[model samples]
Target chain A: MGARRQPGAGKVLRGLAMRRPLKEAGVLLVIALTATAASWALRPDRLPLRADPAFYRLELDAPLIDPGPALALYDEGQDLFVDTRPAPPGSLPTIPGAVPIRAASFDDDLLDLFDFLAPDDPVILFGDGNLVPVSNIAARLKERGYGNVRILRGGIKAWIKAQGPVTGTASGKEGS
Target chain B: MMRWLGLFCRLAVGGVFVFASWDKLLHPAAFAAAVDHYHLVPYPLLHPMAYALPLLELITGTALILGLCRRGAALIAGCLTVVFMIAIGSALIRGLDITCGCFHTDGGHAVGISLLVRDLVLLVMCWPPLWLADAGPRVPFLCKKD
Candidate 1:
């Protein structure tokens, strides 16, 4: 910063010269050019991890799996249901036995919530995909290393559309 | 070619930060969720930090591109990049699959070695200003690529 002097250009060049080592100059130049090259080497379309081509996204119109499969998984007891969506305003018909965890509540200290389930339980996540409180929660949970966790394709909207049951108390007498 | 390069890079980087901050302003709850996913900041202080940081990003990005406050904007960007690098590094270390939602993006906003490389590039941009400060009173951002 002493280089913050009047007639700043000369001092600045001096500063740069002092900073550059002759032996390292060629190496540094090559490195900088190589870095810029490497940036080009990697395309924007793929995830960097694993280099698995499957990770590359497909066409946006690729037909998504219907929610019937997810609903079957939930009904079969093969998948533990977790609702990552926000609770509706009043009594809402939620799939019975599905655990409703606010997506807002999932975070790094996931161990705090680990007690919610058995470690090895197969878990399927349902969210209101169009309103992403669900998928975001699932993504965060996946971040926490939940191996068997998955986001329900097209989310719960697909469920109701699949003829999956939504439980609401007729009298608002039963708690969902 | 260089001018186009400069213009594009400035727009891409500046646009990204501004876009990221917009969600924080509009959807405080979602923004809070995004920040909390990182788990670095404590829960109690998380909300304010979430609210302020994105707005800071937005202002700084706007300043950088508009050339209204170049040095300060660059510094803010550099600092945010460093913080993001740290946060992503922490997620990797902790074994989190967290997306780098600096902009509230939902798709796997991939993180890994690429993230480190990305930030380092932005960090290098900080050097131009320092060099320019020494050269003389100059424009906030160089359009050398432009």
Candidate 2:
């Protein structure tokens, strides 16, 4: 390809030159800072805990106790098990000595059910297979300053598989 | 036709950004919780970002709407839309059930394909600014040329 030379090309190019994108970027930054400062002033207390790992951790990260260890803890009477599922139908069973703490009733009944337990007492939450309820309950307990909160791994299904004692027919599966 | 369409796009995108920022500005804690639900942001950065993001949205949105450094606002909005798409897409692929913190922090709306598509449309709206030169002679707001 051959380059074509035009008269007064430099002048034409100079006339067509646009402002640098960087200047525009700087303008945007200033505006962004102003808006952020205004928002911050409006809700200074709304800032979240910066380094709190507890608030950031997901449900899966909640400690999971297998059936064997949970049963051992149960036999030793060293831990309290809280079932996060709704009450099972007449055909399905629940873990022996496990207290029912429905997720729906969590906000209202949490203190009532948990007020009797010491802050350091080990608490385990269980459902059928889903860990959401179990994990949430554990988080709630931890939020209320309860230490040593955990979720039952694989829920009541694993408990049944391990032949753990139950209050009703133990063969059926249940949802969280 | 092109210029008018571009103006329309600019105003619409900016208005949306402003609307989205209002709730997050009012409820930083809820926004932070929604950000936490995404599990994409680092723990240490989450709080600061939660505090900062709404302001960014508010500024950029206003810039777009007012035609103040329209290209710059479009750049920011485009980048934000991309980041949101990636976060939402990752959550969908990973099967993490979460509420999208788009307009609400308590999250009545679930994150899904529909939300992603809406963001994509917004992202598309950002194109006119990226591809076209700024209209008029004098720069608005911050950058006034010699």
Candidate 3:
């Protein structure tokens, strides 16, 4: 009965009672380090960070195009219509002849998709009426040197309302 | 009652750590991107952590689940949770729109209040083993196969 040991004191005392606190911690650290090393050596999909390249930044003040003009561009076939939705173009009724550049794979797929087009190609990107995702894709495209990148004002939903042609596996809603 | 609860806590904590490690281990690139989105870590160390963190999670989680070095595992788990909490908290404070990177390497759950509370609950679960007296039979949490 030298002194009363508080309930909370037991927690503090447990550290002293541990057989080898440093050794235990060291072992855990070693395990973590080893695993890290192994992952570095073994894992194939490790992406390293890099500085931004010399590409021009996309203008934040870029205006959104009306569905009428957007649909007209699609009709003319002079502009490239890009559906930035996560779904593949094949899965959804999209602007006819639109290429699916999924926002998920924005960096890689966008680059590949743009490789086939000219630097001056007028690319109209549309999503599920979400400004953030659609703007993000357009901005990235503009950054990569595309001068004419536009977001459809209300995305696919608006395109449908404007009686634009929507043809795919999910068709029959075009102009109806 | 305490013993049963501690066991449940151990399982819950350990199971979570293990499950969280799987996706990060398989897809380090996605994890690195998520980390980069945080903009906290220097660009150089990002990939290194992406690789190391999952392995640490795997080891501690397994150890905690098996009751091997339970105390040590619990401590490490608690520390990791704290680090995660701080990271999430900082991101929230800064209003950074980034993925939590807690479980999925891929962008599954966006960082927000719910994720922060989940981690806090996990930290609390790591507390019991730290304070309670080791009575009856005691098992060493480290370097003991038995």
* DockQ-based CAPRI category assigned to the predicted complex of candidate 1: incorrect
Q: How close to the true structure is residue B19 of candidate 3, measured as C-alpha lDDT?
A: 98
Among residues 3 or more apart in sequence or in different chains, the pairs in candidate 3 whose N, CA or C atoms overlap within 3 Å are B69-B141
Residue A163 of model 1, lDDT score: 77
**CA lDDT of each candidate?**
0.56, 0.75, 0.74
Sequence-dependent TM-score of model 1: 0.43
Candidate 1 lDDT over A32-144, as tens digits, reads 34533443345332112222222122222111233656677766777777776666423555666777667555552345457766656677766665434554565566566
Name model 1 segments beyond 4 Å from true: A1-176, B1-12, B133-146
- Native contact fraction, candidates in order: 0.00, 0.56, 0.41
Tens-digit per-residue lDDT, A1-176, candidate 2:
59896759777754444334445656787767776666666663445346476634644635666676788888898788887886633445777777777767776656666567788878888888677667777777777788788787668887877677877655555433
Supply candidate 2's per-residue lDDT for B34: 84
Give RMSD (Å) of candidate 1 vs. truth: 16.0
**B45-72 per-residue lDDT for model 3 (tens digits):** 7767878888889888887777766777
Per-residue alpha-carbon lDDT of candidate 1 for residues B73-135, written as tens digits (9 for 90 to 100): 555676778998999889889988767776653344766778888778877764453234332
Return whichever of 2 and 3 wins on lDDT.
2
In order of appearance, the predictions have TM-scores of 0.43, 0.56, 0.57
